[model samples]
Target: MLRRIDEALINRANQSLLNELEADYAALGDKLARQNIDIEAITRSAADFQIAVPSWGTGTGGTRFARFPGTGEPRNIFEKLEDCAVINELSGCTDSVSPHFPWDKVDDFSELKQTADEYGIKWVSVNSNTFQDQPGQEHSYKYGSLSNTSKEARELAIQHNLDCIGYGQQLGAKSLTVWVGDGSNHPGQQHFQRAFERYLASMEQIYKGLPDDWEMHIEHKMFEPAFYSTIIQDWGSNILAAMQLGPKCKSLVDLGHHAPNTNIEMIVSRLIQFKKLGGFHFNDSKYGDDDLDSGSLHPYQQFLIFNELVDAEYRKEQDFNPAYMLDQSHNVTDPAESLINSAIEVQRSFVKALLVNREALYGYQEDNDALMASLELKNAFNLDVSPILAMARYRKGAAINPLAVYRSSGYRSKMAELRPRDPNATGSGIV
Candidate 1:
C-alpha cells in the first residue's frame, strides 16, 4: 500500500507507547476473563471493523453563515483521495470513500479507480445531489428535483441518479444513496400526496437502472431547505418508499437527521426487523443536522445503536449486514485529523458493543429486571476499550495513537505547501 505517513515515524511512535499499551491490554483482558469474555475475540472483531469516509468531508465544511477554509484542503476528487488515504493509513478503519456526484465527477472513471486502488481505497455508495442546480443546468432545483411538478426537472433528476449508478459501476460500488431536499417551505405550497407520487414515479425509473447485484439506499431528512415539510421526512416515509420500490431498495439512516431525543436505536431495531436497514451516515449533533464528529457528544447513544447492531449480528437475522460510513462536517478542526478521530470513536463503540454480555442481558430482560439490564449495558459501555483498539491498529501496521502520529508527521503542513489555497473558490456548505 502507498502510505502517506512515514512507516518509520509510525514505528517509533508505536514503540514509545507499546509498553504502556500492553499493560493496559493485559489489565483489560484479565478483567474481561473474570466475566468469561475473551478479550482476544473482541480485539479481532475490532480489527475487522471498517467504515467509509465521505470524500466531500476531506475539505473544510461550513454553515450558511461563512466557510473558513482549512489549509491544504482537497481541491478535487484526486486530492480528496490523497487525504482519505492518509486517514486509512493512520486509522486502518476507513478503506472506502462515499462520493457525491458532480463534485467528484471526472472524465475518466477507470483512471480514478486506478488512483484509488493505488492508495488502497475503494468506493462505497455513490450519492446523488439534485438539491442544487449545476452550472448551465436547464432546470432549477429551487423548487424541487425528483418530486418537482415540472416534468423537465423530474426527468433531469432521474437522469442524474441513473448517471450516478453508471459511475458507481465503473468504480466497483454496489449501492446508490439518494437524499433529496424536495418539499415545501410553507403550508399549502405543495400537495404532499402528489409530490410523493411524483417522487416514487421518478425513483422507479432510477430503480430500473440499478444493476441486479446493486442496491438503492434512500436517505431521509426531517427538514432542511424545505422547512415546512420534507417529502421523505422520517423513517416512516423512508421505509414506505423502500417497501414500494422492492427488495433491492432500502432505507439509510443519517444519525443527525432526527428530532431531538428520538429513539434512533428503536428505529434501527425496526429496520432490522423488516430487513430494510441499508446503512448509516454516522455523525453527532446537538440539534438538527449539525454534522458534528462521530461520538463527539452523546457517545452513549452511539453505543446503544451499536448494541442493537451487535444484537442483530448475534441473532444472525436474515440479510443483517449494514454498511457503515462516516458523514461529518469539520468546520473548526483539520478534516484529516477529525476523520481519523471519528473513525476511532466509531470503532470504539463497535468494540464496546461486542463486549456486551448478551446472554446475561437477555436473562435480565426475561426476568424483567430493568435496573440490572440497564446496569449490564452500562458495564459494557464503561469498560475502556482503548487498548483493544490500539492493539488492532498496531497489528495492522497502523498508528497506535493516530492523531499524535499525524501531528508529529507534520503531514498537514507539508500538504499546505503542495496544495495552495484558492482564494476565489466557493465552499460547499456541507461535508
Candidate 2:
C-alpha cells in the first residue's frame, strides 16, 4: 500500500515535469530556430552531463572553529555510499563518487566496490590525505607534507599517495588527487625553492607509481593551513609543476581555491589550451576557499566557466575531458539535499551555456561587434531552463522535485532511526 503511494507520487511529479519540459523546449526552440539549431541535440547533450559527488560531502561540514554533525550523517564509506545514491537517484546527474583516503578508507575494498556497484555508483577520483598527521605516524606534517624539509616526512607522504593509487586501481578509479598544506606561515620561515623541489621529488615517485592509463591531479590552494603561502598556490604553479612532472600529471581547479575576483574561466581556457586540464573540485566562496556549495554564491561565474567549456567542445574539438567532482562542505542544510541542489545548479549552468548561439557569437566576433557577442551569451543565460532540467530528470527516471521527494519519503528520519548519531564521536577532514 505504501509502495503504491510512493509510485503514485512519483508518477504525478514526472508527468508535471514532462509538461514543463514541453513548454520550455517549445519556447527555447523558437530562440534556437533563429539560428537554425536543433533543440533535440542540445537536450541530448545536456542529458549526458554527469558530475561526481564527494564522499566527505555526504556528512556535515564545518569550519576550523567547530563542526555540527547532522542527524543520520554517514559514519563510514558504506553509509556515505547510501547517501550518495539518494542524490544520484534524484538528480540523475551525479553517477560517481570521489572518495578521500583514510577519511573514507575501508577494509575489504572488493566488498566496498561491490557495494558501490549495487547502488549504481562508480568511483571518480581517489584523494590522498598528507596534510595532517596520522595516528602512530613517525613524522608530523605540521609544517608540510611533500614539501617538508624532513626527508622522512616527504617519504611518508609519497608512500601514502602510492597506496591511494593502488586502492584506486582496485576500484577501477583512474585518477589520484593530491593537495598539500605545505607552506610557511610566517615570513622568512622557510626556503620556497627548496620546499617545492622536495615536493616535486616526492611527487615524481608517486607519479611513476601510477598505472600508464591513470592521471595524477594536483590541486592548488591560494591559502589555508598555510597563512603566508602554499606550494601549489595558483594555476601558474600548478601547470608548471604538472609540466615538470610529465604527461600524466594535470592541474585540478577547486573553485574555492582561488583568491576573490580571480578570472577562473580564463585560467580554465588556458589549461585546456595546454591540454593539461585534469579535473575540477567544484565549490563556491565569498572569500578564500569557503568550500560553499557550487554555484551558490556566483551562478553567473559558474555559467561563464561552462561557457568556456562548452565553447571548447564546439570549437576546439580538443578531445580534452575534465573530470567534474563536488568538493564542498556544508555546515547547514542536509548534506544529501545540499548535494542534490548543487548538482542541479551546475546542470542549470550547463544547460544555459549550451543555449549560447555559437555561430552568431562567432559572427559577432568576426564582425568585431563585442557588445552583440556579449549579448548573444547573455540571451541564453537570461532564459530559465528549469523546465528543461525537469524534463531531462523525468526522462531519466529521477525526481522532478528531488528535495520534495526526499522529504516526502522521510529518508532522513529513517536514516536517523537506523543509524543514530554519535554524540561522543568526532570526525576528520575539513571543519
Candidate 3:
C-alpha cells in the first residue's frame, strides 16, 4: 500500500526547522514593525490565500516538440485527484481544483464529486473543451468550433458548453472558462467581423444557460494553431464578447497568452476598473505562451500583477473578487513539486504586495514621483518574506518546507509502482 504523507512525517520534518523559523520570523517581524507594517497580518493573509490547481496539471506536460512522461503520470481523473490531494495537503493554500471538460469527464459525477470531497477539495472554474474534438464527435473543430462557418459545428460547440455547465452544477463550481482556437491561417481567409458575430451568437446561447451566480470567462490568446488571427485574440475582443454576452460574462487573463513584453498589469487594471475581470490562469513565460512555472523567469512581473490585485483589495473595489489558479505546463521536474513551488511563489508575491504601503504608493502616484513610486514597489518586492510564508504553512498544519517534505515522501515512486505507465498517452501540448 502506498502510504500518504501524514502528520508524523510532517512533525518530524518541522522539528529541525522550528527554531530557525522562529528566529527568522521574529527578526523579520521586528524589521516590519520599524516600517509600521504588521507582519502578523501579512502572515494571516498568506495563510488565507488560496489558488485552485488544474487537475490535468498533475500529469506530465509537454512542449511543441515532445513530452518526456514522468514516472508516475496520472492515468485518469481519479489518480489525478489523488495527486492533487497530496499537493493540497502539503502546500496548504491550494484546496480547490479547476477541472477541464472531456479530459476529466467521468461516467458518474456523483462519485467524482464524492471522491474530491473525501480528498478535501472543492471545484472552482469548470473548463470547457470546444478547442479540440473528442472521440466520436459529430462536428470536427479542425477549422473552428464556436466561430465555425458550419452551423452544425457551432451548435455542437454551444451544446458542449451547456453540458459543461451541467457538470459544474453537479460539482458546485461557480464559473466556466471558454477558450477557442477559431480563426484562419492565411491572409484574408476569414471574415473577421463575420467570425466574431458567429462566435458571439454561439456564446450567447451558453451565457443564457448559465446559472444566476455563475460567471462565464472568455480567455484570449495572441496567437496559436491559427497564426494569422484568432476569434477572441486579445482583451479588447474578449471584453467585447463578454459585454455582448451579458453581465454573467467577463474576460480571463492568462499571463503567458500575450505578445512578448505586453503590459499585462495595465490590462488587469483596466478589467478591474470595469468589473469585467473574471479571473486568472496563472503561468509564466519567456517568449509567448511557453507555460513555464510561475515566477520562474519573471518574478517581478508576477509581483507587479499582484500589486494591482492588492491595490484593488486595499481600495475595496466593488465586485472585485478574482479567482487565482496556477495554469503551468510542467515539461520538466515533478509536476507536484513544481505546483508546490509555484503556489509558494504566488503566495510570496501576494504577501510582498501586502507590504507595499498603499497610502504611500497612492501619494507617489498623485505627486508624480515616478522614481520614488518605483522604489516603493521595488522595496516591497525585494523583501524576503520566506519566514512569513513558512510560518503561515506551519500555523495551518502544512509542511514548513513543503517541497522538501514532498521529496522525502517518495510519493511518485510509490505511485509508479502502483500504476503502470501508458505508452500511447497524449497531452495538450503546444504543437
* Highest-scoring model, TM-score: 1
TM-score of each: 0.99, 0.95, 0.98
Q: Considering lDDT, where higher is better, how would the candidates rank from best to worst?
A: 1, 3, 2
Instruction: Pull out the clashing pairs in model 3.
Output: none
As a TM-score, model 3 comes out at 0.98
lDDT of each: 0.95, 0.87, 0.91
Model 3 per-residue lDDT tens digits across residues 1-431: 12257778998899899999999999999999999988899999999999999998997788777778889789899889898888887888999999999899999999999988888889999999887778899889998999999999999999999999999999999999999988999999999999999999999999999999999999999898899989988999999888888888999999999999999999999999999999998889888988889999989999999999999999999999899999988877899999999988999899999999989988999999999999999999999999999999998878999988998988899899988887666644556
Across 215-240, the per-residue lDDT of candidate 1 in tens digits comes to: 99999999998999999999999999
Stretches of model 1 off by over 4 angstroms after superposition: 427-431
lDDT of 3: 0.91
Please report the TM-score between candidate 2 and the true structure: 0.95
Report clashes for each candidate as comma-separated counts. 0, 1, 0
Question: Tens-digit lDDT track for model 2 on 1-431?
Answer: 00212556666777766666687768877877786867777777767989999998998888787788889888899889888988888888999999999888878899999988888889988999998787999999998999888889888899999999989988989999999988988999989899889999999999999899999999999988888978999999999999999999999999999889999999999999998999898889999989898888999999999999999888865648899988888898999989999999999999999888788899999999999999998888888788677777777778888888888888888889989887677654452
Candidate 1 — what's its lDDT? 0.95
Pick the winner on TM-score between candidates 1 and 3: 1
Q: Tell how far residue 32 is off in model 3, in angstroms.
A: 0.2
